[model samples]
Target: MSEDFKKKFDDVLNKIKRELDSIAKRIDEYLEKGEIYRAYRIWRDAVLDSLKMLRNALNTLGEEFKDIKFSEDDLNNIAKYTREGIREIVDKLEEIGNRIRELRGRGYLWIWFDLKPIKDLFQEVAEEVNVTMDGVLSHVEKFISSLEKAFEDTGRRASQVVSVRIKEKDLELIDRLVEVGIFRSRSEAVAFFTRRGIESSKDWIEKALEHAKKIKELQEAIRREIGGEEGEEDKENQGKP
Candidate 1:
């Protein structure tokens, strides 16, 4: 009976490992093709399924091994690490989603852009998650280390919300820009225009300053020329007197 239970436990662990490998491969392939959204969908679903399977397997293992010398505390710690690891991956996915929204708002459809860097980032995260999951099934200490390594690879960034009110005409213009493929969405259009406007304002200010400087130099030159002419006339008048 103990042998049978141990065989089943090993089988479950092997199955989890296989599934994790499959999922990681799929994610890598998709990301390599620059299909970020598709990769994200796969990642989200695979993580959820893997978590469910992992939890079930852990529960079954604990029940079967209760009579054995296995420490319940160790099992509980494993479960905790698994949950926390999944949470961390999910949080990273959410951050990516938010960034997508932000890009769309700025009139950037990254779909048409070179996304190798972004894809690489996703691949890195997916690989990390897979490695961490494997460690969770094998050793708790390694699992923690893997998770921390993944987090360090992907540093954290702060974000904030901004509100703006646009006129109907401006909104229409944004739509037209999107229609013309200048942007992927209204948000993207708005973001693009806002950035362009800022750049244009800076340029205008620079040009204005240059013109003002030229005007000042011209005025000084005119004053000097006029003063020289007046001095010459006064000399002529003095000589005649």
Candidate 2:
């Protein structure tokens, strides 16, 4: 990941974490004062905002980790679990909406807005979201760690993660390789074939890309010179182990 991208990702993730905490506090304050009606709009607005944030977070994860394929020990069904979590949260939010509307429809009865049920609902949703968000956050943080680790130690034999889309036939071919025990996993099979394919094109690539290689070398030299001029910081001070 690029430095600019890492900064933006951190900002987005922090905003999401802050938003959820703030939403709960705001709603609780209104509910505590026996202002169920006042909490209604806050609840509705929070739902919309939360949904937007959830989607943005998911999209960011997908984009940032698009190349980082997960093994069974890594990110498992990120899109699926995150989407399902979003759906459940939305459904809970909808239930809260319906309850608020029902109370509002009564419109005039002092006793109609019991507030207890909705309060319970707020608690339920909080618990649900906390559990779901924990999973999402852990996976993202893990991805960031993995990305940084790989980038920093190019020569280290780290367990790299790569994710990508494949056609039906392509997926079947990968699976077939795994089934035959030629590879331990779909990731392994994909990596093997991909490396092999690149090697097969080495001759043509070298012949046709001579100018490009020189340009790339120039860019690398410039980057190296800039690093030297700046006196690179210690990894330990930068939060490395």
The models' CA-based lDDT, in order, is 0.48, 0.48
Question: Any runs in candidate 1 off by more than 4 Å, and if so which?
Answer: 1-7, 67-241
RMSD value for candidate 2: 26.4
Tens digit of per-residue lDDT, candidate 1, span 1-241: 3345445655765675566567667766754543444554565455446545646665565555555442334443444544454445445444443443343232221112122333343334334433332333444333334444443332211111122334456666556555544456565555555666534454654465566667778999999999999999999999994
Query: What are the runs in model 2 whose C-alpha is more than 4 Å off?
Result: 1-25, 28-37, 70-76, 104-241
Worst lDDT window (10 residues) for model 1?
Answer: 154-163
Q: Cα RMSD to native, each candidate?
A: 19.4, 26.4
Every model's TM-score: 0.31, 0.30
Candidate 1, residue 74: the lDDT equals 45
TM-score of 1: 0.31
